[model samples]
Target: MSQFGKSSAKRSKPSYLYAIIGVSLILFLFGIVGWLFLNLKKSGEMFRENIQVHAYIQRSATKKQIDSLQKYIEAIPYVKNLEYITKEKATAKWNAENDTTWKKFLDNSPLPESMDFYVKSDYMNKDSIASLQSELEANFGGRVMSEFQYPTETVGYVSSYTKYIAAGILLFAIILSIIVIISIDNTIRLAMYSNRFLIKTMQMVGATRSFIARPLNVRAVINGLIASGIAILAVFCFILLVEKFVPWLKLLRDGRNMAIIITGIIIAGVTISYASTHRSVLKYLKMKLDDLY
Candidate 1:
C-alpha cells in the first residue's frame, strides 16, 4: 500500500506543477487589472484636484476681512490645496506664464488677488461645485467673495465620464474574477485526477475519508501559497519594469489597494484549490470500483 501511494504521488507531482503555474498566470492577470484600476482612480483624482476654483476677493476689502474669509474657506470640508493669491503673486504668475512683466505694459497690475483651492474628487462635480459656490458667495452676506469661478465645461466633461469608466472597469474585474475561479477550479480538479486510484484504494481498505484526504488537502494549501507567491512576485516585477519607463506612474502607487489585491489573490487561490481538491476526492470515493477503469 505504501509503495502504491508513493507511485501515485510521483504520477501526480507533474500535474501539480502545471496546475500551480496555470493558476499563478491567471492570478497575475487579475493583479494587473487591479493595479490598473487603482492607477486610473488616482490619476483621475489628481486631474480633478488640478482644476482649481478661484474665489475673487474684493479689492477694497481690508486685510483683516480677507484673512477672516480665508480662514472661513479653509474650514470647509471639501477644500484642498488652498492658497491665497496676493496681487503680487498673481502678477508674477501671469508674467512667468506669458514671459512678460505686466509692469512693462501698464502702471498697475490688472491681475486679481484671489483665494484659490481645489475641491476633493468626491465633491468635484458640477452640481456640487455650484452648491459650494452658492455657499461661499452667501458667506459674509455675499460681500467678501466678489466671484467664485472654476471651469464649468471641464468639470462637466470629467465628472460625467468618470462614472462610465469606473463602471466599465468594475464590470471587467467582476467577469475576470468569475473566469479566474472557474479556471482554478478546473485546473485543481485535473491535478486531482491522477490520485483517484490511490484515494479509492485507501477508501476500500477502511481508511476514513478525512484520513485519506488530510495529506492531499494539506498539499493543496501549500501549492496554493506557492502559486500566489509566484504570482505576486511576477506582478511586482512587472510594475517595476513599467514604472521604470513611465516614471510618473510611480506617483500613483497605492500600497493599500495593492495589499487588498494581494490578499484577494491569496484567498482565491487557497479557497479554490482546497474546495476543488476535496470535491474531486469525494467524487472518486463515491464511484463504483468498476468506474475506476
Candidate 2:
C-alpha cells in the first residue's frame, strides 16, 4: 500500500482526544455522585446522633432526687451524652429564638426542668427511644420526670424517608454504572477504529496476537490514567467548592471512605478502558482483509 493510503486510513479514524474527554466527563460525574452519596449517608448519621430525648423533671422533685436521677441516666449503657436543662435556661433559650418572655405572663415558667440526652448512634430510632423513655419514666417516676417525650415525629420521618432515599440513590448508581460501561466501551471502540487498518496490516505481516495487542493495551492504560486523573481533579475541586460554601458539610467527611471511593474510580477507569481497547484490537486482528474498509 502507498504511504498516502496509510495516512488517509489514519485520518479516517475518530479522534482519541474527544474520546478521552468524553470518558473523563462521565467518570467525573460518577465521582461526584459517589461523593455525594457518602456525604448524604454521613449527614444522615449525624442527624440521628443529634436526635435527643427530653425527659421533663417534676416541678416538686427535691435536689437529692434530681441528683439521683442524673446518676441513674448516666448509668444507662446506650446513653451517648446527657444534659440538664433548667426551666429558666429553657425559657431563656426559647425567648432568644422565638421572641417570647415566659417570666412576665406566667407565675412560674411553664417550661419544665428537663434531662436532655442523645442515644447512641445505633439506637437512634423510634423503637429504641420509645423503650428508653418508658424505662426512664418507670424507673424515676415522680423523683425525676413528670413526663417523658422526644421528637417522635422526627424519628418517624427519618424512618419513613431513609429507605426511599437509599433506594433512589442505589437505582441512580446502577443506571450510572451501566452508562459508564456502555459509553466507555463505545468510546474506546471508536478510538480503536482509527487503528483497525494498522492492526490488520501488522497481522498480515505475521505479527502475533499478543504483539499486536501489547502496544495498544499500553496506550489504553495511559489514556485511562490521564482520563481518571482529569475526572478526579474535577471532582476534588467540586468537593472543595461544596465545603467552602456550606462549611458544615465538612463535618460529614470520612477520610478513609473517600480514599476507597477514589481508588475504586481509578481502578474502574483502567479496567474498562484497557479491556475495551484489547477487545477491539483482537476483533480487528481476526477480521477478513476486505473488512478493513
Candidate 3:
C-alpha cells in the first residue's frame, strides 16, 4: 500500500507541474497576441488620420464659380462629403478662434470663402488626392483656386516609419517565441529526464515508439489546450481593463474582426503548445541514457 501511495503521489506531482507550465504558456501567448492586436489598432487609426485631404478654394472665386467647382469635384469617385464655407462664415470662424484680434480687424479685412472637400476616409491619400486636386485646379483655373493642401510628406514619413517599426516588432516577436518554446521544451525535457530509466525500461520491453509517444502526446495536447484557455482569459481581462481605463481604445469595434483576432489567439496558443511539447519529447526519445544522466 505504501508503494501504491508513492506511485500515485508521483503521478499527481507531474499533473500539477503540467498544469503550472500550461498556465504560464497561456499567459505568455496572451501577452504576445494582445500586444500585436493593440499595435494593429493604433496603425488603423493612424492611417485614417493621415489620409485627410484639405482643399482651399481661391478667394477671388464667386459663389457661382465655387458652386460649379463643388459639383465637379463631387462627381469624382470616393468623394464622401463636402462643405461650402462662405467668406462671411470663414470670417466668423476666424473671429471665434482669435476673438480679440479678429474682432478688431473684422471691419477692414475679409476671410476667403472656401469649399472643404472631405473624401471617403480611405480614399484620402497622396496619389489619388493629388490627381483629384490637379483636376480641380485645371478645370477651375484662376476663377476658384487658392491652395490644394494635403500633407503628403507627413503621411509618407509616418507610413515609412510605421513600416519599419512593424518589421522590427515582427522580428522581435518571432525571436521571443523561439526563446519561449526552447525554454519550455527544456523544462519538460528535464522532467522527462528524471524518468529516463523508466522510459528506457519500457523501450527494452518492446514498447513501440508510437505507443511510448502516445501518453506524452496526450499530456502535451491537454496541457496546451488548458494553457491556451487560460491565456485567452487573461487577454479578455486585459482588454476589459484597457476599455475601462481608456474609453477611446475602440480598435476592435467590428465584432467580426474581434472574433477573428480571438480565434487567432486560441490557435496560436494551441500550436505553440503542441510544437513545444512535440520537439521536447522527440529530443528525449533520441537521447542516450548517458546523456540523460
lDDT scores for all predictions?
A: 0.89, 0.84, 0.64
For each candidate, what TM-score against the reference? Answer: 0.95, 0.80, 0.71
lDDT-better candidate, 1 vs 2: 1
Model 1: per-residue lDDT, tens digit, 1-293? 88998999899899999999998998888888888888888899888988989999887788888999899989998898899999899988897788664467799888788999998888889889988888877775356778888999999999899889989988988998899889999999889988899999899899999998899999999999999999999999999999999999998888888898899889988988888898899999999989988
Clashing pairs in 2: none
Q: List residue ranges in candidate 2 displaced over 4 A.
A: 1-14, 59-81, 98-110, 120-122, 138-143, 241-257
Best by TM-score: 1
TM-score of 3: 0.71
Report clashes for each candidate as comma-separated counts: 0, 0, 0
lDDT (Cα, tens digit) per residue for candidate 2, span 1-293:
55844784567444677778888988898898889888888888788889878888888998888888888889988887898888778988788888565466778778788888988766887778888877877889766689888888999998778779889989988998899899899988988888788888888778899998998899889889889999989988999998999998888789976897788679878999999999999899889989889
Model 2 residue-pair collision total: 0
What order do you get sorting by TM-score, best first? 1, 2, 3
Q: What TM value does model 1 have?
A: 0.95
